[model samples]
Target chain A: MNSDSLWEVFINACLINNFVLAYFLGICPFLGVSAKLETASRMGVAVCVVMLVSSICAYFIHRVLQALNAPYLQLIAFIVVIASTVQLVEMFIKKASPTLFRALGIFLPLITSNCAILGVALFQTNKGYDFIQSIVYAFGAGLGFMLALILMAGVREKLALARLPDTVEGTAISLMIAGVLSLSFMGFAGLG
Target chain B: MQPEKPIVIRKEVVRRGSADEFLKGLWRENPVFVQVLGMCPVLAVTNSAINALTMGLATAFVLLLSNLLVSCLRHYIPPQVRIATFILIIATFVTVVDYLIQAISLEIHKSLGAFISLIVVNCLILGRAEAFASRNSIGRSLLDALGMGAGFTFALLCMGGVREILGGGTLFGVALFADNYQPWVVMILPSGGFFTLGAWLLLFNRIKQRQQRKQPRLQARLQEMGSEQ
Candidate 1:
């Protein structure tokens, strides 16, 4: 795990094992916020920022937890820190862009529950990636997530105008499209 | 006579209401098929039946315990910090379950990966905590947790069962078909998870639409019977 270069880690996290499409992380916001391209891009950016911040926090916290010899508190510690970070992000976003904040809505706080963020925290710790590797991994995962969300939003926008059966209209169609996207992502398996 | 009739009706209504609370999660408002609350575990760990069932049970355990704790402390927890407090309680339980699963079987633990910890993020559990458990009584929340947990398990099994059968030509590692039976390898991949869930959602939509179509007819027939009586 530690032998891989930063580029390999980035590629592995971004395209080969894309968070949303490949690992099934962050599906909630991926589906819920991807309805509009504008909102999706904003949400993706918000998530990317949160991921970057929380990833840094998690790295330092993990080191502290290790020094303290209280590994069991890792989950609780990570979550509490993530929650606080999200609160900060929420306030920042609200001040910077109220429309974006409103558009993001509950999902902003709900980012606390976005598994992709936590997954990065946990995966980084588990994979034993050092400081730089962890940052690159988070960046790659965030990029992958944003990429997936933007692509999904674009597809959904087109899908809205196309005629379709009632049963296949909503989440079912989205999942089907996501499945195809995931299949295409699988083609990147050899890249890393 | 009227007073007595009203009392009996009220008692029956209470009984039915309690039953509804429990029964609704099993089918009507399933956490997965209907509400689509937690998609990570639903898609991530369900590549095999055993993995799916284990994940389901682990999630149910967290959901059940968290619901119990949240309802018990509902009043003590203020509105502002309730979400954080709920998460703290949930993360504690997930940590416990994480170690518990690790102790039980390292291989299953490995297969489940960080998902055991990710239970903290499963919207279904937190949704229940915020939406149902925090507002409801202890007994009611307990029933809700059980029902939702069972429903979650049922849905995971549905996905796991199909995927395993088609993907591996086996159920719970037991080979069911002859040597020549070919497995659809895609059925077990990440994309397969999406496809299987989409298929399930489509089926559920169809069933719901059919039931809705029959509902008015059934209501009219009932009204006609009442008039005749």
Candidate 2:
């Protein structure tokens, strides 16, 4: 908003430089919990919420670390904050929406370990984005992740009945689909 | 894997030894190729052989050190707080590694970037700490970490070697092909990373299937002989 175009930030993070397709930030849930479209979309939303929270938390934390001259605490602080935030999110989702909780299963809590969430925090800081830009970057990363997960889920749903070679029936086929999807995503590079 | 299988491996290792614990992750239970636990670093930093090697070594160091600590302090860490504690230990080591890489080579450190810090979320490391290290004895935990770490490193090397070769017609900066070789530029791009990993997975799957089929065919032939007799 200040200097860099916000739309470009969104597009670059969401498509041109997708967290999953380009950065390989959140492949775990992209491959594991992305079997069904509904679940995949929910997971995507959950990640979006978490990424937004963590990005804000990290932005403030970065300011503090800079003031204290203790930037080394960034990794440990970011992770602990993110992990506990994920726990809070998990409990909230559990009590607030049992159906969504059931759909999420272990993956809700597993968000603590999801690199994409942390990657958003790390990458935004590296890029030196301001508060507004950081939030946008985080949301864009979450959207890109959701986009990748949903696309992969759609393909995998069809793949369940497809006659695949026994060797490539499971993770291999998923990887192949992701590969193709990533290949197509490269076309967006020029758009951004 | 199946929940019951680890118990079976535990029983066999109790009687025979802990060698299988280390050997399994190398191939059978490979964290990357087989289990697919840590895909971010596996795919992201393997654009060059040297980068892959450095990233693998950095991860292995963290995995080994963190596993040792987790295993050593398993009992003191209540189940309620185990994951949090394990992560703290991992983050500490990752920070140390981040600085260490920077000290060694500014370029390598910059190249590795946040992915080095992202090692804390590798899942392979955390998965091992929770599943094997936190429950097993220290000696067994050490072996498990070494094996899984090596398996991850090996898988990275395989991907890196292929990507570097095809992407640039070089292996660790040595030209493999002729001077005029038209390098497949895709191999170095992000999509190339995904495609290369998928190819490796395909190759490993086929090899495993062939081995499985041979064993089944051999068993069928032996059954026929027995019936004839």
Candidate 3:
């Protein structure tokens, strides 16, 4: 409904306000699953898929909830939709390709709880973006989440070999790396 | 008569167990520093002391109520549908809280943004419900929720206090320094959240490592003293 262009929305969501780094939407999986690049990328793609589906579903659900004069149910509705959609995605992958499923099996269910997916739905609605804009925004957010994940995974791969204090070995070190990454991403501000 | 007597005696044990359940969440099994269960809001709303405290309390409220409800209904919920049921219950309570927060203070609500509603997905709340509440009694679940909630609130306070002090040169909106004092603005930014939490985790790990180191020495000293006696 807003007059913002699709490109601007995409750019804004992807870079200027990255879900993972800027907004800190999905730090759980961002830190948990970013240890290995292969799993991280696959997890990123799986999240992207779920995000897109939930975004579209949210757009329509918002319309319905508005029509019914029941806006209060939006949060509950959005979460239910997201959980079911993730279930559907899980099933589709399980049947389509057992290998890919094996790679992504565990992370798929976790995608339900990932704040980024729910964030996309909530933000798109809060911004009052039209259906097309919502989809673009979702895609952009997904891309941004994936980009951050892959980048972190790459850095962590090397960090594994670096000499570090025993105290700063695991999560503390990764969080520090993410902090630096977030600081760098600040440069992309105002691009849109 | 014998069973009744044992039940009375076990009541005292239950009270002591409740104390342990409540105390563990404050430090040992802290939801933030130790368990690191809910990181999204832990980092997102912790830009300031008030925001951090408010968000922490809000989450604790939800966790408490949901845990109570979940434990009360645990016997009735089927295993296969339990997760779904849990989500539904959590989502419902989250909605109630969402409205409650909005009514109480729009300003705070605005600051929290969608993260307020996002409480439904907070792994800490759901994690506690599924792991602790579902299996525990109502009284124990309440204590567990309180402890974890307090621990979570305490952690948020730690992060918020540090970030606000460094980032804005103030605590809870009161200026801590002169006008010329330069705030470490980075401490309040998105990256600052990561850095601050990481530093806290580092400190926690250091303390834990030191404790592990001393634990064996203390045991050895005790053994040596016993042998001498």
Chain A accuracy as TM-score for every candidate? 0.94, 0.94, 0.98
- Which 10 consecutive positions of candidate 3 chain B have the poorest summed lDDT? B11-20
Q: Residues B1-229, candidate 2, lDDT per residue (tens digit)?
A: 7899999988986865566888888999999988988999999999999999999999999999999999889889989888889999999999999999999999988888899999999999989999999888999889888998899999999999999999999999999998899999999999888889888988988998889989989999999999999
Where in model 2 is the C-alpha error above 4 Å? Answer: A94-103, B1-16, B220-229
Q: After superposing candidate 1, which stretches have Cα over 4 Å from the reference?
A: A94-106, B1-9
Q: Candidate 1 vs candidate 2: which has greater TM-score? A: 1
Which lDDT tens digits does candidate 3 get at residues A1-192? 698998999999999999999999999999999999999999999999999999999999999999999998998899999999999989998999989999886899989999999999999999999989999999999999999999999999998888998999989999999999999999999697
lDDT of 2 by residue, A1-192 (tens): 246788989999999999999999988888888899888998899999999998999999999999999999999999999988898888888899998888878777878889999999998888899999999999999989999999899888888878877877778778878888999998998996
As for candidate 3, its interface RMSD to one decimal place is 0.6
Q: In candidate 1 chain A, where is summed lDDT lowest over 10 consecutive residues?
A: A104-113
> What lDDT is obtained when candidate 2 is compared to the true structure?
0.90
Q: Which ten residues in a row have the lowest lDDT in candidate 3 chain A?
A: A103-112
- The true-versus-predicted C-alpha distance at residue B132 of model 1, in Å, is 1.6
Candidate 1, pairs of clashing residues: none
List TM-score per model, in order: 0.96, 0.92, 0.96
> Cα RMSDs of all predictions?
1.7, 4.2, 2.9
